[model samples]
Target: MSSSLEVVIAGGGSPGHVYPGLAIADALRARLPNVSILFAGTGRPLERHLVRAAGYNHMALPAKPAPHNPLEAVRFITDNALGFMAAAWMLREQHTSLVIGLGGYASASTVRAAVGRGIPTVLLEQNATTGRTTKWLSGMVESVCTGFKEVTPYLSPVAEVVHTGTPARPRFLKQYQQWQQQGEVVRRSREPRIVVLGGSGGAQTLNKHMPDVVSRLSEELKDWRVVHQTGEGQLQCTEDRYPSDTSQILTVSYIDELASLLFETDIVVCRAGGTTLAELALAGVPAVVVPFPDASENHQMANAEVYREAGACVVVDEWAAGDRLTDELTSKIRELAADHQRREDMSRAMRGLAHPDAADAIASRCCEILCGTDMRVAA
Candidate 1:
């Protein structure tokens, strides 16, 4: 008889992968009271600290992205494969029941090992396109879930794809509640408020330009509030580096209340990470998406283009992020703020794109699969 009573999830190093993985784990636990959850990650701050703080056990492994050079590729594989072997060994000994790959180097080792063991597995892809790590391991898993149905055409026909929507931090929902309580006074107020996020570790591109942009705001726009999330280390730099007054700007390494910021926001200028896009959609907020240019396969750019085509966001190429970006943003903000009908239409479009129940859906599906419930039953 199978003895594993635990679900093992592999993802870490970046908040992009870690946050969703945590949400899935959190959801699974809420549904399945009997099963335990474990994580395999590279021990990045968000992964290790946040997961642990959430009261879950984390099994750290050494894994890095596969190399571009043929010579470095061998070294990378050897390193990651060994880490995989270790994670597999851990799973083997722990009596793991289900294995999940959330896509990233942290999962590289665990996924390889789990598939070889014939473990029932679920892999989640959050972008409109699958990453190379996920694509390579797609067929090995029993099912592949995606955030957007749009990613379906890119995957292998043999891979069973389900549209699960993207799993976001619980704060997204919590913040929505607060927004409802604030009523029309704050909601309909003409004060222009912009929230800017630089993604997990912070966007170097945003860090450099945001300071300048904050500096250039005119006295007429003095009442405008800019909230900038620059990730951890940049908080101090943001605090002292920029000269903007507290009333005009608030800069932090991270904001625990991200959802609150969303509801209060008139506009969002953020990296086009899948989760950010999903959150913007869920919150019905218009945005300016500046994708990370060096993102693998230019996936961020692709993600941004999807929303742009839908008229949900404006795309700003990373190459042109400084100086005039402030002018460009000011122009767009005024345009979006003045054209009430246009903003409303785009907000409705954004709301249409949200999957508020995605986290619950993925968690429930994985639990059902792990609990010996047959997939033949409808979801």
Candidate 2:
């Protein structure tokens, strides 16, 4: 291994793109303690906060999304051209050994620069359907690490596709191992709990409608508790919807320890972000997946379909449900909550899909590529 080796992980714009990159970073640092890791991404507040809070240095690039119309196309070119120049400079200045792209427009410029410089590059695709950036750069990168095997057909035939599963954060991985050792024991003694997640950015539809959905299940949820993570700035509005007399439902802005919470949760009502679904699989939690309808290329729906086919979740299209969205969600929650045997079956199916060693697998691949020697890192 080269002592002077430094790597850049490029991706952002959302927590879905950033968290998996962080997980890979953690695994890389574990194997190479002295190597420098820098995160390159867009100048979004969420991206900046997450990287800095994880104690990694981050460089903000002038990247923007692909233009939708002719009017925006010119600006897109100007912004990304500047981004590509900045990325090339950063790669040269840092003496970058490897560049890992985490599949988003935010990562396009940096990865393109890396390939142009003939640097070793890898791309991580978290969706079942390949992202536009990943599809565009797939043939050029050294390897494309995928979360779902269904994504294989979408990538360039020349692209080296590795099904390493999705990399989850260290905390989640730790909890997942603990669950494995404990076996599949259902906790019936404690109060059954339901958790609602709207991703890092609160889902307006979920935040506005889920309170009512839970309220509708009042009779069935007499002994059950609900925890709603309403994202930032939406807590007050969410809290207002629940009845004041009952303390059964608790609303919070964010969950810092989601891995811990998932273990205690009976079921989840959430968006179908690839990273979130990967975590749910690790925890073996049954879910009522309400995929964000407007996700890029409807990728969230594609992600949910995999879990649905595996019998791990019930897919609910919020938009298709129309005015019956609340009723549909309520029905799914009620069904899952009432059937203990079914929940356990779904839990087992979910666990069957988990890749506990995903982070290590990806890091090992990166190490092998960097050193030109096959290597596996200890978890």
Best by lDDT: 2
Candidate topping TM-score: 2
lDDT, candidate 1, equals 0.77
Model 1 lDDT, residue 197, Cα: 88
Residue 327 local lDDT, model 1: 70
What local lDDT does model 2 show for residue 348? 90
lDDT, candidate 2, at 84: 98
- For model 2, what is the alpha-carbon lDDT of residue 363? 87
Residues 224-286, candidate 2: write the lDDT tens digits. Answer: 999999999999998999888898899999999999889878899999988999999988899
Residue pairs with colliding backbones in model 2 are none
Q: Give me the runs in candidate 1 sitting further than 4 Å from their true place.
A: 1-4, 68-75, 177-186, 239-241, 244-246, 320-327, 374-379
Per-prediction CA RMSD (Å): 3.2, 1.8
What does candidate 1's lDDT look like per residue over 215-244, in tens digits? 655453467777888887788776675784
